[model samples]
Target: MAQSRTTEHCVQMPAHGAGQGKTAAPTPEKQLNCFVRCIALIERLGNALGTLAFTWATVVLLGGYPTALSSKDFRYATAIVSLEAARMFSRNNRLDYQLLFRTRGAVRPLGWNGLTVIVPAAIIRIVLASLRLGSHSYYGDDGHLDKRNPGDKTNLVPSLNIFYGMVLGQGALYIAACMLDIFSFIPQRSLARQGGYADDDRLLRKISGQALTMLAMDSVNNCLTMLRETGYVFIKELTSIIRVDRYRCVAASLLRSMCLHAQQELEESDQRELSYALREVLERTLIADGAELEIFIGLSSQICKVIPEDLAKELEDSHIKQRFVMRLVDVLNSYTEPSPHCPGIRRVILEQAINMMEHDSRYTNCFIDRHMAEALSMVEETVSEAENYSLFLGDVGLMEAREPLSSLMARAKQLLAVR
Candidate 1:
């Protein structure tokens, strides 16, 4: 990978001596300056067109369409007039900042921040032009009018609603796009603050932590917004789809993919705590209930397979892994129904799997062994419950299997290792 990726790129010119023959010169700065001037001119032109559109509307009302300009002429003129105004604001750098103000609170990090601003701005202009055309059509005649007394224009107040609608619609689009525009400078800014304020390790850790935090926040926000907007429709749709085994399989697979991504990023990062935190967040978000406990296990197993044996041993020995597993088991158990064959009973099974995976692996540090043993014991109890319910699952699916109270009690002793 390159050392740094800049948002704006400039081509380098070949070195030239004082007497170099007719060498082409660098013009990036000149080009940028020209772009700024063009944007300013567009904004000024837009303001002028807006004024002209307003004037035409007012004059059209005072004088009938036949008296001023033909209906078609008015429509075309109004469209052109509104488009210029829209173009002005769309090209203005300040408009992008205005869009982001709701979330980021009036911060101008990078001016307009590349094409993230350009696209919506152009669309807004097109929309404005359409609105102006529609308004003129609605208010003005199709060139057919009574010569004696044309229809009154005072009833054309609804025509101005175009401007109101444009602001609401285009403004919303601008804000939505701004939310999605992720400039690379966010992490860069945090990294820059590292000097003197914090040591390299601490700064890197914080940067990594914030990255995970942003991911969590963005995911939740997007999901909740989608749910809020289409929750009722989706509920009906899900009712039909949830019954299909294939749908469940597809959903479980997608969730596994998301979890795998989180795990991989955490594993790659040098900050162990941040990685563990991300893993915990994933578990908490996706595995809230034991509905897909087996899928979680299968995915974790797959991820563990890809991990290097030596590093996996170090990871297992570290407090990060054991602590995350313990917390996960605890949360899983709390949500697991109390039955011998209930998946909560399978929590211990996962612990055993984790232990088996780490058992032969040696840790250079002895202190980690105690925590590992404690985590294993917690897993053992959960597994003992599952053992009692295995007989029930022999006849029924694991989801439907529930252990008898007496069997559960009996299994508790084995699980607790009490004679």
Candidate 2:
């Protein structure tokens, strides 16, 4: 019986050497395929090396190292091109090529995007060049021009030239690159909307949506920088001349659109990843300058709804929940006086808190037992005076604040009961 079974198994399994005995000659097509793959790998490596070399060169240039390639003009040009390439790489999500292929260490934390690094580095180089050029006049001892006599309003020429290059040339290129980044999502978004791949397209839609959201954030940052740098007079006269409401309206609309798109595309798993990423980023941003708080709050609100219990439990286990909650509380506490924007942010926080409570019963007891009193005290203090309430609720629209406040209070009661 054993011999019969062995014979049956041998007959069922094909001979391992059968194909080797009848080897077919390699074809031209097969050779071409191998050649193409080799070329692709080489090209990928070359691009990676070029990016690293440029990034290192940028750092060296920033450090004021006197290299053979360190001419002012060359540095400026290199900075612009390198920054543009970095932006392009980030937009295409190719920034991970090096990390994936070469790195042995754990992946870097993710809140700060490529723009945070590249844009500032480029701007610094340009500013340094401008300052250096500005310090000396073209009218030097070589019969070029005259030296400054008690600062004669400083040499405006070189400074203005630098400003023009940064604003017009490099700035235009950055803007164009961002627009292209945004536009690249259109085809993917279209495919998602058309249901081209049905459930399989969910991940694609989430990725594209996230990319667009990041691009929008970068664009907003760029615009804010432009306004801050160029519109000093406008900023001074902001209250009297410019209607803050109009600017707020436009910003809110843009944020709302991005949030809606991102929320629509995200699956539960996507939400978990996004939550993890955003929290890390938020923690970093809060520690840094906190410039991206508005965008962070907007996105957080969209993703905070109906979180999966498993994800909530994971976050709880990892202590992310406590950290995030504390950060939100800190944000709320920071705005001592009522601002137009504060109400929207507060509403989102309350909504998110309430969602957490509903999704995981443990969250209510955990948060309320630890943080409820402090959080409520901060909110109460913010809205304490009638004038402040009027501003907060009026700016937020009374109808909008009513529901969130009610829900938040109800959740608070539940937590209080548990405690």
Candidate 3:
């Protein structure tokens, strides 16, 4: 009887322990999951606070709130806040396969909705601030009309402040959107694995379209702002701004974006109209000599990769070919002394010229006949006596240059034979 009682006690104790063990196992897991949720909540709250703070600061500074800060300080603060906001929005609202695939159009605005509110609000604040400044200037600080004359300097200060604030705010938003668009190309592994080429192409087109749309909106905003500020002088001021070399960089970026869109369309549709549009943009861009020229060169290199046949045919136009060849010769002439930035551009131009030549015998014949002498002259100037002799004696850079030129010459000769 004692043994039986001892066995029963032992079995009951184990069952009780087993029940406790089962109860204890899930407690740690539950605690871990709760902790993770808390951390996520804190992170989200922190982001919200940061974004709110940035938006408030932008409004206050651009709105010209009465503060100890000078105009310069206000300008700097506005710029900094704008950049930070851009960085934040870009981080949160990335353009990726996940965004393109998972989300429906109805819910898409929620991703970047904050930006829509913030940008317009800032613009309105600036306009109201300008109105207040104008009112104060006209009515005097004491609220009575001042006998003092409103000089040009008096009017100019407020206008300048308003113009700068609006431009800075709009520019920041544009930069952020651009950054988002550029990064949208990063492939999401899960989406990519499930999707096909057709899906990827669709995503690319959507991204490109969005980028173009943003560019258009920015251009229109700038034009409208200029018109509002300068009134009748808007056209003159707009022309002057467009003429600036820095502004040409913007145009180049716009052109590059357009080219990317055209390239995509060409791939999908293989339409001659797209090719012609690309040719027209390229022709206009090539005519401009400035930072734009470098951009056009880069664009041409990209075009060579995508639309070589179409581009070659476009170059076969006598006027276009002549202008392009002359530009190449000028670029070569600049590279005669071998500057730091020249070699890379020179190589691309040469490669593009070679591609054109390879694509069409007629273009090769025209290019070699019209520009070969200029190229040889530039090459002779570039290759010094020691470098020339070292070619037979095997100098690295000289040998590298010789090989491409020789290959180009060989291609030209072959084209001439075929002609």
Candidate 4:
């Protein structure tokens, strides 16, 4: 759906790759005297990337795998890319501009009233590196006071305590900055702008709230999956996966929401903007550098859902429905990721396709198009394999009486066959 999450946040390089305007054209006085443009550009880069790094870490290190896919991740990444984008972050109270500037964005503000924030952080880090505080100082490899000569008065290296404190401080500031990114969201005012009334704002809030809630639920569920009761954990996991679908259902609902919202509520300009935003959200959530099968399955299900019906008669959707579905079908035809662990996606991808065919003539045409037949067959195999794996576990000492994979798989297969 998107080339990268960081696209929105890209730093404005001075005359290199940024500012395509006549007024922005560099002058000899601006260049030779103080390097003002260069300094400002560096400051902007430092603020954007430095601040966003904390938020990005909260996603990848703290949240799900392929963390770049989430809207939350994009939200932060966009901030990191540019100062103009950063303005958007602060425009709707999406971020605390003051607390943020004091932390990662500047660390220590400088220049004419916070025009450049990189000065203090850049200076401190530079000084630390020069002192070689945590490096090969006079104390040698271990940096122990005991190993150093008492008579060596020339040893001007900083104490290990000071070095450790500096290192720890860096980490502390990062965590604090991460707190800002973690709490930020697509709040009601983020979408509510000129020409958008109270009702529109309320609707936007509702939609945003629902999307955010779903994402939070997924995050909680991902965390929950890590925990297992003492015994029969393997069988329990398999059984749980049998009656499941997560992302597919989410994508379906979101697609439905986006189309309906665009059709009913927005003006032409607002409609395009809102639709694009939703698509980007979809792209950010589903498409990825390390795209998961579950996401693609979710996407595929929604494609099946979207193609069959005209949810918005006048609302023209761009790229989301058509291109991605073709890509999804192609990917599914070649999808090699293990389905035994995340069987929910395998179940729903087929189910959505099957369900769509029953009501829509267009869906019937879609049923036999492209490489869908092969994709469906592959999905069916995954279901069969997952069922077998679950049964094998049950057959072993890891048995559970209320087993569901067998019956579930049969029903799925029956439905698939009927389609």
- Evaluated with TM-score, which candidate comes out highest? 3
TM-scores of all models?
Answer: 0.25, 0.32, 0.33, 0.27
Give the local distance difference test score of model 3: 0.41
Task: Please identify model 4 stretches exceeding 4 Å from their true place.
Answer: 1-278, 281-293, 296-322, 337-344, 384-419
Query: Clashes per prediction?
Result: 2, 3, 1, 4
Query: In candidate 1, what are the lDDT values of residues 121-240, reduced to their tens digit?
Result: 446555655565555544346534454664554334444444434333444444334433334334334333522333444333232222221222213232222223332232233223
Ranking by TM-score: 3, 2, 4, 1
Across 358-393, the per-residue lDDT of candidate 2 in tens digits comes to 666777776665666576666655542222121111
Backbone clashes counted, model 4: 4
lDDT accuracy of residue 297 in candidate 2: 55
Error of 3 at 339 (Å): 4.3
**Candidate 2 regions with alpha-carbon error over 4 angstroms:** 1-291, 309-318, 381-407
Please report, as a residue range, the 10-residue window in candidate 1 with the lowest summed lDDT.
1-10
C-alpha positional error of residue 402 in candidate 2 after TM-score superposition, expressed in Å: 8.2
Error of 4 at 394 (Å): 18
Tens digits of per-residue lDDT for model 3 on 289-328?
Answer: 4334554675565566566777767766634777776677
Model 1 lDDT on a 0 to 1 scale: 0.36
